[model samples]
Target: MAHITAGVATSHVPAIGAALDNGKAGEPYWQPVFAGYEASKRWIAEEKPDVVILVYNDHASAFSLELIPTFAIGCADEFQPADEGWGPRPVPVVKGHPALAWHLAEKLIQDDFDMTIVNRMDVDHGLTVPLSLLFGQPAEWPCQVIPLAVNVVQYPPPSGNRCYNLGKAIRRAVESFPEDLKVVVFGTGGMSHQLQGPRAGLINREFDNAFLDRLIDDPAGQAAVPHLDYVREAGSEGIELVMWLIMRGALDEKVTVAHRFYHVPASNTAVGHLVLENALG
Candidate 1:
């Protein structure tokens, strides 16, 4: 049966993608950020998961006020990158694993989690940037991707606890699948930094680091964190961290920290990344 081998948590800052695409990654300003992921790129290449369940928020590119599903799973064969006002990033199209995706949707819904099943949707930086950060500039992504979009752009986004529980359900679903496959669950977005309002450029390194520490050592405690705390301390967009709980919930109780990286001011946002494997793996 298929089993989850690891979980990754990252910040999907769009400017990081632009820097890579514009050939500025080697420039002094961006070198540190890119350097942090060097070990990650090497590690993922070695692990080589067959499928990745990428959890990210759609940044109004695929869905807006007109429609938002609290939790949506992409069951399509492929996903095109969105324009995001700059035309699609010059990246390869995203090939998806429809079979595994549909299985997750069915199992999650049956487990009492309401999920919107998407047959087609253009993926934006929220999804692609993480891919680039880990996989680099490959002509094509190394493995099949399954987009699991969570709605953090809107108010009343799912709680950390709910997302965490959803991750547990996903693990159960994956193990029951008949295929022998290695899967990695990616939780993307957040590490303090708001894009607008008085606190638009907010960056709380203390809070961000603390959150990461808790995420690795005490996930259930982190999952119980309330929304107001994230808004007040980490900034509004900081709520994106809740999505990380989902990735944590999918892993074993104890995990080996394969790699961890964090940096500040990537387009006025905090960039954080972690690679964790099942303790036994």
Candidate 2:
């Protein structure tokens, strides 16, 4: 059985990328924010995963407030980049691993995990920022992507436990894949802080570290944590931590945490990264 070799979690702040590359993102306050993705970049270079399963929530770009699916998988052949405020990045449309994606989509449905399969959709900075940080916008990226986009932008979002269960389903889907391949699973977004209203730039390192500790030592306990707790304490949009639970549930119990980093105020969000070796002996 093919196994997931590495797992990474990152925050996607479009302004951070913009400031890193163009030196100006209209927010002078966020310019010197130290491009918070160097570790993920180095990890990709070291591991060179064959396929990357990216779990990220769209910001009402692909799926609007009009309709939201609990969990959606991108089964498209290619995904064009969408413009948020500064416009889309100058990169080729993302190439998808349709064969694997389709198989996984069907398997998720078969496994009693309802998932929305999308054949045509454009990716926004949510999916593109990590790619650019880790792989840069070369003529082609080093690894193919299997996008698992969650509906986090809207209210009544999927529960934290719900996302965790999806990870378990994803593990079954990937391990059952017939091809000889190595995989990397990514759970993107959140640790603390909020982006809207009066609560913007709020950082809670205490809550963030507590969540990280539970994620490795006791994931079930972590999964049992309610979404309301995260929203109230970590901020409303910080509910995106639910996505991290998805990545956590996909891994085996014995995960060797090798490298970890956490920081705050990265474009009105808290950023963190974890590198876990699968099935630690």
Candidate 3:
């Protein structure tokens, strides 16, 4: 049967992609951020998961105001990189795990999570930056991906509890799949920073750090935190942190946190990355 080997959590700042694509990764401001993921990149190369279930939000790139599904799973065979105003980052197109994706989608629906099954969609930086951070600029991604897009853009995004429960359901679905495949779940976005109005450049390092600590040691308790706390304390956009719970929920109750990196001021967002291995996987 398939098994979930690990989970990764990170911020998906677009500037991080620009830094890598424009050859500014080694600059002092960006060096530390990239350094944070050096260990992860190496570890991922070694672990070589067969498939990655990436949890991220689409930033008005693929789904505009016209339609926004709270939870959507990509069941397509391939996905193109999206051009988010500036231009599409020079990243390889993402190949999907159709068999596994369809299996999970079917199970999730039966499990009572009304997920939108997307046959095709262009993935934005939220999905690709995490891959680049872990795999570098590969000619083709080493493993196939299953994009799980959550709606964090609109107000009243899934609550922390709901996201956590969804992750648990996903873990159940994966374990039941007949293939003996290895899978990794990634929860991407947020440390703390707002990107609108007068508070556009807000950064709450204290809150961000505390969040990391809780996420690492007390995820179940953290899952009970209300949405207002994330917006009011962490910053409006910091609500993205809720997505991290999904990744946390998919893991073994006791996980070894292999690596963690946190840095601030990445173009109005704090960058956080973590790699977790399931103890009993």
Candidate with top TM-score is 1
User: 1-281 in candidate 1: lDDT tens per residue?
Assistant: 99999999999999999999999999999999999999999999999999999999999888999999999999999999999997999999999999999999899999999999999999999999999999999999999999999998889999999999999999999998999989999999998988899889999999999998999999999999999999999999999999999999999987899999989878898899999999766
Regarding lDDT, does 1 or 2 come out ahead? 1
Each model's lDDT: 0.94, 0.79, 0.93
Each prediction's TM-score versus the true structure: 0.99, 0.92, 0.98
For candidate 2, write residues 1-281 as lDDT tens digits: 65688677777777656764574633556533344455556767888887888999887778886779888999988888887767777766788899889989999999998899999888887788777767765888778888899977777778877888888888899889999778888888787878778887788888998888888788888888887899888998778888988888788876988667776667677777787768631
Q: Considering lDDT, which of the candidate structures 2 and 3 is the better prediction for this target?
A: 3
The 10-residue segment of model 1 with minimum total lDDT is 272-281
Candidate 3, residue 156: how far the Cα is off, in Å: 1.5
Each prediction's total of clashing residue pairs, residues at least 3 apart in sequence or on different chains, is 0, 0, 0
Ranking of predictions according to lDDT: 1, 3, 2
Candidate 3 — which residues are off by over 4 angstroms? none
10 residues in a row with least lDDT, candidate 3: 261-270
Error of 2 at 167 (Å): 0.6
The residue-level lDDT of candidate 3 at 96 comes to 99
